[model samples]
Target chain A: MTNLQETKPLMHLLSATFDSLQSATPEQLEHNPFLQLRKQGLDALARTGLPTPRDEEWKYLNLAPYIRHPYQLPAGKESLSHLPQILPITTIPVVFFNGLFQPHLLSPVHGVTVTSLAQLLDRGSHDGTALGEQEHSIGQLLSPEDDPFVALNAALLHQGALLHITQNPSQPIYLASITQSDQPLFVNLRFAIRLSTGTAATIILDLRTLSKTAPTFHNIVSEIWLETESALTLIFLQNDTAQNYGVLTTRIAQTARSRSRLYTITAGNGMVRNTTSVQLNEPEAETVLYGLSVLRDTEVADHHTAVEHLAPNCQSSELYKSIVADQATNIFNGKIFVHPEAQQTNAYQSNHNILLSDDAQVYTKPQLEIFADDVRCTHGATVGQLPQEAVFYLRTRGLPETVADVLLLHAFAAEVYEQLPLEPLRAWIDQQLSHRLFDIVDLAADRKLVDLQFATS
Target chain B: MHNAKQPLLTIENLHVAVDDKQILKGVDLTIYPGEIHAIMGPNGSGKSTLAAVLAGREDYTILQGRVFFDGKDLLEMSPEERAAAGLFLAFQYPVEIPGVSMLTFLRTALNEIRKSNGEEPIDTRTFLQRVREAAQLLELGNDFLQRAVNVGFSGGEKKRNEILQMAVLRPKLAILDETDSGLDIDALKIVANAVNSLFGTIQSYLIITHYQRLLNYIEPDYVHVMYDGKIVRSGDKTLALELEAKGYDWLRSETLSSIELPSTTT
Candidate 1:
């Protein structure tokens, strides 16, 4: 990190990207407030450079190849046929392909307003709605100084969706970011969600790739603002192929009596990092984070989360489980901070992992900082294989070892998805889990399991 | 309903060890179809070890001996294969498997056994009917089938669940190892009645216990006394009453004097 030789490749890439951005579009610069933010982000990127393994947060993942790869903007035209099959669980869909918003695919909902950040900035006045009202809340919450990738995302941010929810939508909004390209490309995406007072909404952010050719590097950042008495249930689904790398960052700011339930599910291969940070700025706010990673082959899924209790009577709980097979790797780093004024706060964090093979790897760390004397905080982590006694018990009932292993692993992961509000989505996940566990999809087994779950519930 | 000449299970000179410590030493026994044989012994006399070894528990190492089930090499099969071959061992302590409903477990197991027998998987209707009948016979509520396998089940409920599984599976030889250990009088009678109801000429039972309290509810044709890793003496149902009155201490002394005698032929 100290030597100039170590930073040369990243520096070269950064300089090239900065020059390209400076010359790419001179016409859209007059009324764009984000242009200044992008310039500042580029300058910051030039100064700070890229992060190496020496950084504590990036210790488990090596980004040398991802950072040094020569990538360009996607040039190939995409079509509707390229869209991967999404389960028909949500009524509304907001689609983004290769970092560009597709207005034609968006379905209008009654209680929600979806507009691009660029359009709002074109109006050039604070209309007391969307990003114009908050005045660059995107850059404020997703500060470029937070991480080198965040700085890169800000430097390259162009088309971002600004969604404002004013009431309980009848159906969940499926915000899908799909990537498919013939050549190596960089896909940068940003989004902001603002929930009005007393409103409740569920949002699903589905990030997937349809291309299996050149690697697609996705850098996505999302900021959320929850007003008083508002609730948000957000599901972040990462289902990219192995030929992709991504960094997904989500930051949430909650007001008084607001609640947030965030779920991060990784069911596909590739290298991805998901970072979520929630801040309770007012009293009586609560946040719960649930994560499950089912990976195999050469896939790598890394998750880092932070929950900060800045006010009294705020509560936070986090549970993350992983089933890693083959030589795949999984990492979890969670931090809970209870400030001095955050008295009577209750925080809990736990991470559990099951390695399907000896080659599978898992690294988990739970960090808690409680300054308040009256706070209750607990954190723990465990990494193990399938319980042998349970396996033998199942085997005694005439199930083969492979079936026993699959059943136990499925049960281990069921805790995360069982609480899903939508039954169809839960059933879809059950089918997906069966496909991930066995080479051939066992539809009968999946059907039986679906019946069991429904009948028992 | 009895096949006296053709033996269903034969264990000859069986010796089993766990972690190189011999648990079963030169044990010999045989049971015919349509027979109910009980093994009454002291706490550490290798009663459960025999049952576990018969059910293909891999922890135990067989230093010497052979076991035959229906004239096949029982020791050579995996636990699942043994189960498919109609050998079931009601565990001394049934392990709890959370998140797998009893209905799913039973159906999957029955389907696997059926597959091994070159038969199609049981239909849903038949499976549910059999499960309901077995649950009712064991006095287990329908809610029990919806619960995770043995999860949060009491000791008595776990034993009853084991009987329910035996009833649904209908194994040729069902080894109940200390199933009566943690049951009250009422649950004991329910479980015994379930076992008795399932008994037939083709299905045999090997009940292992430390006391003779359960023998009153379910009569056994023959009773064997196991001591210090060997079947020291075996007799009829009257022997259970004799052991209940005189206790295992009297047999210990008598066994000491008869140690050099050749093992029983019958």
Candidate 2:
């Protein structure tokens, strides 16, 4: 165990804000169901302090660069009219600015309930109905004591969305979380999503910054609950700027015969870390985890995932690919845990990466811990450069060397991009990847030669 | 069709080495315009090395020699530049590119050649029409255009693909490097037919092969036997059939005795 005393100054810098939040007025803190949870989270943080590189989980990533400056909370919301909309607006959009939900940008839909935590808290007491259900679902699966960032998010939690789907809707829902600030600030956000039994829905969560040069720190925590025989698909797009830092922790709990899929796309930010944990608590549950990370220009991206099988006859599949270039670094840690009682568990994990530059670095660990005798588990990881023969073959076809390289890289990333369920989103992601990876502006014009159509169920 | 006027390709005592081990030791050959020349040799006789050096593969080092294509220095150009300058090598073992479609690859190559010749790129409609016509002439289906370049293709299919590319690119000097090695008899005839369909007075061919069967279909105008990294015999097409009848060991012993007789006489 590493001692936290060596980073006393850094710990003090974070604790000062916690102390001020503790001194809020009684009216501001009274009747808040999260108040006790916040206290517990702060106490847990004080016990563990900040994690150092000596810790096994933080061995490859150093947090010293992020914690060097003292970051204060944003006081109020800024203007939102000038921000550019990156995705299609056909679906219902729930906007969050600086961790606070903005009601004006929301589109109301039937059989769906969208509200903020602050609104629910302001309405005071209610019958044991939707409000009670929101309280029961939020913060139920994630334990703040296990992670310091989750604890910090719980302690300084501002506002987030509470989404509930009672019936299957005709269209998907889009959650847009935007952070904008004139000065350096720290923002904490929390979200809870509950799907009723036999319901199906697709949710797209877009996390981005309004400006490319804003120095912001975003700590986000989300808890998702799926009832029996329910199905859900969650797509998370983490696209920030070079001047921002973010950490996102998501916990998903699935019931018997439920199905879920989580797709995470990380392409921006100076330093970003994502931790996604899934619990198969009932029999015959299925989950698929897919992620793609494109890092360039000295940026760093890390993804840590764990899927635990606690019951019998459950299956899980995980696939993640990373493209690192220009001195950038990418880290991936994926684990599949099968308990003694969880027999007949079929789990597979694969992590493949392409390092484009000589200075690019990648660290990948795919682990399977199976205590059950009858279970089948497999995991593999590969890191390599572009195939030399393939490059020479394209050059023989008269494509310039640079053009050949760009085409090969795009093909490498298309393996993961093809897994997107929606056609429009897939095309959008394909265009964005081409621009960011190779500076190709009109990739759509070349679509006739490279595009492949797959049926979506 | 042979015009005994000026040589189209001239290799002047070409000496080549791969990994510092000499492969082609002082070899010379000449081909006239509109003439199909065949070079027959045993394994490891540097037949492939000659093709690779002409294609500018960069793995082989030229110790001392010069190759002139038409009137320009051929060794000074890059592989693509050589292609643009009307030189092509049909690989014995064609490479497999997993995600690049055949249509995309051929279009890019044709446009690149046109650009180098100071011409505009071919429009999509005309390009597709030409590609379909060429593919049909080689007995390939439309799906072959959408498939990745030679990926999952059978040996015969890959050979036909090489010929299809030859028809599309229309190079002046096409060097077929043992392209009939893994092909069956039917595929051999189809490939030969494709080659003969494109043959004209403006083009020439250098066919490198180990068997006389390929020559039965294409019928080279001249045949040369290569031994010990150098040409030891030169004649017309009958030389291939005679060598096929007696095998290469007889020719090897004859060359050895001729050299020894010269040394003893001196």
- Best-performing candidate as measured by DockQ: 1
Q: Give the Å shift of residue A279 in candidate 1.
A: 1.1
lDDT of 1 by residue, B2-62 (tens): 4447788999999999998999999899888888999999999999999989988889999
Best by lDDT: 1
| Ten residues in sequence with the least summed lDDT for candidate 1 chain A | A446-455
Off by over 4 Å in 2: A1-32, A122-136, A439-457, B1-7, B259-266
Q: Which 10-residue span in candidate 1 chain B carries the lowest summed lDDT?
A: B257-266
Per-residue alpha-carbon lDDT of candidate 1 for residues A82-152, written as tens digits (9 for 90 to 100): 34568757456777787667777766788898887545554544232445475436777878888877887
lDDT of 2 at A393: 59
The CAPRI quality class of candidate 2 comes to: acceptable
